[model samples]
Target: MRPETKEITTESLGVLETAALLRELTAGLIASSDFDAALAQLARTSRDAIPGVSWCGVTVLRAGEPASVATSDVHRSDLDRLQYGADGPAMTAIRQREMILAEDLRRETRWPRWTRRALALGVHGVLSAPVDIDDQVIGSINLYSGRPGVLTASRQLTAMLLAEHAGLLLAAVRDRARQSELAGELDETLAGGEVIGQAIGVIMTQRRCSAQDALQVLRSASAALSLPLREVSERLVGSAARPRG
Candidate 1:
């Protein structure tokens, strides 16, 4: 017989235990370098922290497209993909930005296609909590169980907490990536400006003309050659540095 779902109260998970869980999750998130890695850590940690959860998966919007970023087991990727192929809890949770729960796949009438496939995969209960990364980006942290009624109220709370932390960590990762990109552009701009100044100085000396005239000459050459101003400046500077031959 299938074991009855355990309905443990939230009180069973005390303040101290919750604090320890937060610490562990913080360490896991800090060790991750990107959104995928951080969410994968949460999936793995949730499976161990929650009593009834047999596996976990995470789905998010990548470049405005839905993607399954993490799963506890390799085989579970099919289960998440099946949900994407049709309307299911993970997508529903993300769209509505709310929690979605199916107490038992056998009795679930909301998503027929997803339910049928989940039942075949031996997943009976599912709970999805939305992760709010930003105004434009949202996702879901999904918990799966092998028996009906295993997704208790307390476990749902735990899943919600984990999703919240995932959102914050993912936002940090995005911010870091944006910062790095901006820094690269800034460095390129400074280097290009320096080279352009050198080229202008060389032109001024060669033509015995004003700085403005030197810049105009460089611009005219750039337009005639159909090259970027930076490229033209780099070529001119390189040619000027060469010894007479």
Candidate 2:
């Protein structure tokens, strides 16, 4: 049988108010240039706009390590340390790539190390969601509360929505990094085009073809084989050095 679940409804804000808040949050995120600044803004927004959440923070998985990126609470440093040590609810959610909640950390046994430490720090309840990039889990968003059962079904759904947005922002950052690498590679390739040109010349002579025709042959071969132009040029050069069979 399926586990029982609770339904939570929010009556504090009407549809229009919620829409305005989401617009403002998205605008702030777009205005920020870096992940740190955007996360800081999101933390603050969650604290002010969302109800029953005492602390809001983002944890990023870097090089297979979980680290707290930003938070609205002063104890973020401690939390970061806990997560880095792999002894926190945030890390657990990241490892499992699913939502995790502890209604009362003092009594939970699933994560003994995190539970003991969090209870000592006066964290009674916790909610965490994994941040995903193209279905690959990358990080997490953690919300902590001093009261038990603070993250109801409604609050968890809201947090999931926020986490989804955060995932998009992170994906953009990843895309930019990839684009930068590609740009650098293109610059290097253009700089080394002379070698490719020499290979093309060799092809034109050996194949008895015009210059444009040789270039098209090279391009077509590169596309058909799904190889880089540089690799194709190198192969062509190597073939020219081989003795006739």
Q: Residue 42 deviation, candidate 1, in Å? A: 1.9
* Per-residue lDDT over 141-219 for candidate 1, one digit per residue giving the tens place of the 0 to 100 score: 8899999998967667677777887788878776776777667646654678989889989999999999989878987
* Model 1 Cα shift for residue 163 (angstroms): 1.7
Candidate 1 segments exceeding 4 Å error: 1-12, 63-68, 82-85, 184-245
CA-only RMSD, every prediction: 8.8, 9.8
Q: Give me the runs in candidate 2 sitting further than 4 Å from their true place.
A: 1-21, 64-68, 82-85, 134-137, 173-245
Which candidate number would show the highest TM-score if scored against the true structure?
Answer: 1
User: Which residue pairs clash within candidate 2?
Assistant: none
Best by lDDT: 1
User: Candidate 2 on 67-93: residue-level lDDT in tens?
Assistant: 447788867445645543276777787
Global lDDT scores for all candidate models: 0.79, 0.71
